[model samples]
Target chain A: MITIDGVTKIRGRTRILHEVSFTARPGRVTGFLGPNGAGKTSTLRVLLGLDRPQAGTALIDGRRYADHDRPLTVAGALLDGSGAHRSRSARAHLRWVAASNGLPRARVEEVLDLVGLSADAGKRAGRFSLGMGRRLGLATALLGDPPVLILDEPVNGLDPAGIRWMRTFLRDSAATGRTVLLSSHLMGELAETADDVVIIDRGRVVAAGTLAEVVGEHATLEDAFLDRTASEGVSW
Target chain B: MTGPRRVAGAVHAEAIKLITLPSLALTVALTWALTALLGLTGRPGGVLVYTQVGFLVLGVLAATHEYQGGGQIRASLLAVPRRPLLAVAKIVALAGIAAPFALVAAVLAGRPGATGGLLLDLVLAAGVGMLVKHSVGATGLVLTAYEIVSPLVRTHLPEVARLPSSAWTAAVLLVAIAIFARREA
Candidate 1:
């Protein structure tokens, strides 16, 4: 489970997150929906302990992310890019991350196969196309088989087949009782995959609940998102 | 994993990263070739000092490589969140890779005692690289200070020149560590 309680982040004089609070429960796929620059990434960063917040806290499994002795085993995160050096082969990249958390070397190849990147394991990350890069990123996130997974823009460049594969993968991951929190601007994708939704706009939670509750009177999730965000009068 | 084991893993990872960089191979080969050429000609005077530029580039690249392209610094921090440990691991990795090269260059130049100075130069380069955060910018700054500014200072301010390079290197390294430890990745 992930709990973000009244987390506020200020970058310089501008506030990026204002009392942002939400929960991603286990055994469910929680879609973090927002337009660009809506603080989704910032909130995730704080949750991962990458950025310190000025108020409140973000916890995974009842403790701060940094407090975990083996953080990867507690929560695996995929944030922007492939997260590997451009010159590094996919295998070398995973090996290093696994080693950092004391995970066995074998897990590297396991995840490679899991993400269908085993054939491209030896290729330098810089050479991989966008879909390949996202797969590699997902492989890294699965290295520790943690109970929670957090990904930002996981389908930015995937083809239709890759997108379908990802949707099934995320659903299956949640079905197996892992807490999956993914942020995306793709409302259709969220409508298909998300069991719950947390919508934020202009650094604040506009609405959050199960798909039905949040979508209420709107004809679709996209319509609901447009209405909620447009109410704030901010251009996305 | 124990702290030592985690640190060891981080060091190994860092070492792999350094060796795989095309820049590392380029810098080392260039530095060695230049050093060999200067030694062969026996016109080694001040040229030997400039050879340290190669290793200095190596050091700078070592520190700034992760920031290149889309930047792997975020990935690195995610893998190992403890900033101090990550910084130590990087330093240990660079020292390990640089020490042998420094020794070999010193021997080739027939000034084995200068090995210490070369190592100090590597540390100084890495420190400046961390501060600057851009490989090209760090390289330019380090080379200018070492080749042009230091020479001018030594020529005009003898007392200042009397201060050991080791002291400056140490001070810079300390500042680098403090900045790295506190900075958000």
Candidate 2:
């Protein structure tokens, strides 16, 4: 379970996220939906301890990410894929990340296989296509086989086959009674994959519930999201 | 093994990454080839001197790529959130990669590699890599000083001029470690 309590963030003296809060429970794919600059990344950063929130806290399984002894084993995360070193091979990349969390060497290969990149595992990430890079990122996230997974924009540049593969993987991951939280702007994508939806606009929760509940009274999930966001206007 | 071994793994990862890239390999090869050419042409020990600073740019880029990319740093921070631990891992990794190169330089200099000074240089390189979050700018400046300023300083202030690259490397590594640990990942 991931608990985000009253999280507030300010970037460069301007408020980005104001008192934003939500809960992502296990056995469900909770989609963190927001427009660009709506504090989606900011909130993710706070949760991963990349940025300190001026107020509130983000907890994974009731403990902060940093507090966990082997964080990779408790919660696995992949925020962005472009951060990989262009020079390093995918195998080397996963090896070091695994070693950091004290995971065994075999697990690296295991996740590589899980992500269907075992053959290209020796290739450098710099040379990977966007779709392949996403696969590598997913492999890293699954390296520890952690009960919780957090992925932001996991399907951004994927092809149809890649999207289908990702949707299945995420669903199966959650079905195992693991907690999964994915963020995306595509409502239809979320509608198909996410069990629950936490919609945010202008850094605050506009609405959050099961996919069916938030999509009510609107023509579609997209219409519902647009209506809710449009009604709120824009704020710092 | 536990203390330095873990750090060694991180450093090994960085060093291996440094060698694996075709660009980095080209850079190092060019440095060595140019250094050898310079040595064979007229200048004595040019290869040794040039190669010493040549690879520093690659070292800096190793970490700079992480800082520039939003993901690697985040993944690294997530796995090892303790800033000092991560910093140490970098130091260990950089040093592990650097040790053999430094020894090769010493061999080219026709001197048995001395552990004390080379260890110091590795430490300094780590520090510089940390402080700059990658060393392109700093490496350029250092190389510039080595070529132009070091000679002038040596002629005028002989005492200051006597400082070895290895010593400066150690100092830089220490400063880099301090700066790296203090910052948020």
Candidate 3:
């Protein structure tokens, strides 16, 4: 389980996250929905221990991420890019991350197969297409088979078929009792995949609950998101 | 995994990263060519100065590669949240990669005993690169300080030259390590 309480972040004079709070329960996929400049990524960064929050705490399994002896084995994260150096081959890239966590070399091939990048494992990351890059990033996140998965915009460059595959993959991951928190602007995708939703706007949480609870009175999740965030003074 | 094993893993990962970079070959070739040219010119210190520039670039590349192409720094920090371990791993890996080339450069420059100095230059360059966070900017700053500022200072204050080169390198490296440990990725 991932718990964030009263998390606030200030970069320079501008506030990025304002006492943000949410919990991603185990055995569920939580959709972190927000607009372009919203605090979604910022919140994820703090949870991953990449960025420090000025106030409050983010905990995974009741312990700070940094405090975990085996952080990768506790929570695997997939952030913005592929996270592999451009010149490094996918195989080489995975090998190193696996080594970092003392994961077996077999895990490398397993993840590559899982992501459907087995054929191009020898190819440099810079040569991969956007969709391929996303796959590689996902493979890295699944390297340790961590119980909690945090992905930021996981489907940004995937095709329709790839997107559908990801939806099923995430659902299965959650069904296995893992905690999955993914942030995306695609409401239809989240509606199909996420069991819970947390919507934020202008650095604050506007609504958060189960899919049905938050979507009440609206024709769709997108419509409800538009209404909630629009009321928060966000134009378009 | 134990701390030592984790450190070893990080070093291995960093070494792989440094080797795969296309610029590494170019930088090594440049260093050798410059060393050879200076060796022929019969200016003993000139060879060290010129060849060290290439070593400095190696250091800069080692530090800034994490920030390249949308950044692998996030991935690195995620894999190993212990920043101090990560920083040390990088330094060790960079030094390992630079040792052979530094040795070759020293031989070509006719100051084979200066291999230690060349290694020190590599570490110092990497440290400055970490602080600056941009390869081009770090390279320019290091080059200016070494080629221009250091000479001017040495000419004005001869006593400054009495300080061991390792002391300055160690000081820069310590500051880099502190920043790496404290700063947010």
Candidate 4:
């Protein structure tokens, strides 16, 4: 389970997250939906302990992310880019990350196969295309086979087939009881894959609940998001 | 994992990064090559002057490499969230990689005072890199510092400290540790 409560963040005098409170339960895919610059990445960063919040807390299971002894085995996260140095081969990148978490070296190959990047194991990360980079990032996330998965715009760079594969992968992950929380601006994508949804606009949670609850009488998730965000020229 | 074990893992991971970074091998080779060139010319004096440039760069890149290639710092911090510990592990790993070479460079320089700041240059470079996150900028700043400090720190007895006062050192050390731990990834 993941809990973000009253989480507020400020960067350079701009309030990026305002009392953002939500919960993503195990065995459910929570789609954190927001438009560009709407604090999705900021929230995820705080949850992962990559950034500090001035107020409130973000918890994985029951403790802060930094408090975990083996955080990778507790929660796996994929943020922007490949998360590997450009000069490093994918295999080398995975190996070091595994070593940091005290995970076995074999998990590197296992995750490479899981993400279908085994063929490109020897390729340098800088040489990867957008789709390939996403795959590499996903491979890094799965290195520990953690129970919680947090991703930001995971399907942003994927091709159609890749997108389909990711959709299936995230669904299967949640089906098997992992807590999956992904942030994206793709409403149509979220509508199809998300069991629950949280919509943020200008650093505030405009709405959140089950996918059905969020969509409500609106024609689709897109409509609901547009109705909430595309108005009054308010973007902070 | 206990604190020490976790630190060990971080250090291990950091060493692997330094080993596999193509630039690391290149930097070390260039430093050693220049050391050899200076040795052959018999201009390798008590303190290595020209060759200190390579060691300075080695340190800066070692510290700032995580901020490159779409920022590996995110992945690194994600793996080891104890930010201060990560920073310390990074330096420890850099020391491990550079120590043997430092000894080699000292022996090759064939002078008593040449070994004074071989690995210390890398640590200094790391501290500068932390102050300036950009590698190019950090490298330039570190080199510039080397230029200014080289004349003063010519031998083993003379030391040029970035923060000479203990109080100032403590203040800067606290600031650096806070930045490493609390800065946004």
Candidate 5:
């Protein structure tokens, strides 16, 4: 479970997030929706303890991410796929991250296989297509098999097949009782996989609830998203 | 994760990443090639001089690549969480990787008792690399600093005090990399 309460983040003189609050529950996939620059990444950073909130708290499983003894085992996250060295092979890239958290070495191969990148594991990451890179990033996030998964644009560069694999993987992970918070601009995809939705516009929660509750009579979540976005007139 | 252990893991991960980059291999190869060329030309002043340039480049590339990625800074912060601890891990790892190469160069260059100074140069290079975050620029600054304190200019200084400028170069490199890597952009 993740709880963010009254979080405020100020970048220089500009306020990025103002008293934003939300909760992600176990056994459900929560889609974190926001326009670009709406503090989505900043909020994720705070939740991961990468950035300190000026006036509130961001907690995971009742404690800050930094406070966890085995952080990877509590929450696995992939904020961006470009975190690894481009010249390093995919397998080598995953090896170091897994080893850093004392995760078993075999976990590297397992995740590579899980992401269906085992065939290209030895190839340099720089040579990978954006889709392949996303898979490698997912493999890294899944290395520790934590109870919570936080992914930002996990399907940014995936092909249709890869997207299907990701959706299935996320649903299965949530079905196993893991809390999943996935952020994306792809509303239809989110509507298909997300059990809950948290919508943010200009850094504040505009709406949040079960998918059925949030969608209402919009016919589709994309239409609902467009409605909320247009109604708010918030340009990210 | 808590205390020194997590820091150690962070450092280890950083070190592996440091060494595993093809750039590191290329830099090492370039250093040996340059050293051998300088040797043939009878310019084997000190091992510190031979290795400083390459390691300095390593330092610059290491930090800049992360900055360019737009995510390493955040990932590193998430992994370690403590500013000073993370800074220490980065500096230590950079030094650990550079020292041996500097040492080998010093031995090959036949600079008697210059291995220690060469290690110091590595530290300085790492610091500078952190600051400039550009291998070419960092290497230039290190070279400039080296020339300023070279034996030719500081002849009146004590033989030990006149230790190759590369020694101080490493120290400066450490301080630079630490400040640059840790500071909020």
Candidate 6:
């Protein structure tokens, strides 16, 4: 389970997130949806303990992410690229992260195979294409097989088939009772995959509920999102 | 509480990172080559200076390697969430490499410098790289201070400059540790 309560973040003079509160329960996929620069990444970063919030707590199973002795085993996170140094191959990269968390070396090969990167396991991360990089990033995230998985822009660079594969993978993970929370700018993607949805706009949670609830009285999630996020400006 | 096992895991991970780095092998090979060539050419003191530069760069290489993928640092921080422990693990891994390399370099170069000092330089350079966040800038800054400023300051405070290389390295390393612990990954 993941809980983020009253998470307010201020960067420079601008308030990036204002008392953002939400919960992602296990056995379901929680889709965090927002437009670009809407603080999706920022919130995920705070949850992962990469960035500190001015006021709030992001907890994985009732404890801050950093409080766990084996954080990887508690939560597996993927943010931005493959998270592998350009010089290191995929297997080498996974091996070290595994060693840091005292995971078995066998898990590395397993995740590589799981992500369909076994053929390219020895390839350096820098040489990977965008799709391959996302696969590697997913592979890394699966290394620990943690109960909670947090991903930011999880399908940003995937091909259609890869996208379908990721959707199925995420669904399967949730079906197995994993708490899977992912942020995406793609409304259609989230609408198809997410059982629970939280919509953030201008750094605040504009709306949040189950997909059917949030989509009530609207044609689609896109319509709901557009309706809720129509900001104080000239409209087209 | 983080057990010794956790710390060992972090350090082992860091060592693996350094070992896998292509630049690390290049730097080590270059340092070894310089130690042999200059020592054979009968410039014992000169051998140490060159060896120092190579190891200093090696330290920075180990550190800067973390910052390369942009997300690699995040991955590391996530793996070992205790920031100070992570920093210590980095230097520990660095020292693990530099200590043996220093012993060999000292033997090859023959009395040009102390092995302890050589190892300190390499480890300190890694700490500086953590602070500077770039290989060239961090290593260059340390190189300038140790090579250029020390020599210039030595003429005025002969005893101070001669004695405090380790002290200066310690100060840099301590400051770097504090920054690494406090800074956002």
Candidate of highest TM-score? 6
Q: How would the docking of model 1 be graded?
A: medium
Please list the residue runs of candidate 6 whose C-alpha ends up more than 4 Å from where it truly belongs after superposition.
A234-236, B44-46
For DockQ, the strongest prediction is 4
Better of 1 and 2 by lDDT: 1
- Let me know the TM-score candidate 1 reaches against the reference structure: 0.95
Model 2 RMSD, rounded to 1 decimal:
3.4
lDDT of 5: 0.76
Writing each residue's lDDT as its tens digit, candidate 3 over A21-96 gives 9999999999999989899999999998889999999999999897887788899888888998898889988988
DockQ score for candidate 3: 0.67
lDDT of each: 0.88, 0.75, 0.90, 0.86, 0.76, 0.88
Which 10 successive residues of model 1 chain B have the least lDDT summed? B44-53
Q: What is the per-residue lDDT of model 2 for residues B1-185, given as tens digits with 9 covering 90 to 100?
A: 25565555455545554555466556556655665567667665334555556555656554565665435777777767767777767766656666676566555544435434544533554455556664566566655755688779989999886777666765666676667665666
Relative to the real complex, the DockQ score for model 1 comes to 0.54
Candidate 6 docking class? medium
Per candidate, the number of residue pairs that clash is 0, 8, 0, 0, 14, 0
* Candidate 6 residue-wise lDDT, A24-104, digit = tens: 999999999988898999999899888999998999999999999899889988788889998899889999999998999
C-alpha TM-score for every candidate: 0.95, 0.86, 0.95, 0.93, 0.88, 0.97
Every candidate's DockQ is 0.54, 0.42, 0.67, 0.78, 0.46, 0.74
Which lDDT tens digits does candidate 2 get at residues A74-143?
8888777745666678898888777776678899899988888999988878899998888888888888
Candidate 1 lDDT for residue A118: 96
lDDT of 6 at B171: 87
Candidate order (DockQ): 4, 6, 3, 1, 5, 2
Specify the poorest-scoring 10-residue window by lDDT in model 4 chain A.
A227-236
Which pairs in model 3 have colliding backbones?
A: none
Pairwise DockQ winner, candidates 5 and 6: 6
Which stretches of candidate 3 lie above 4 Å from their native place?
Answer: B37-46
Candidate 5 chain A: 10-residue stretch with minimal lDDT:
A227-236
lDDT of 5 by residue, A143-206 (tens): 8889999999787878899889889999999999999999888888898899999888777877
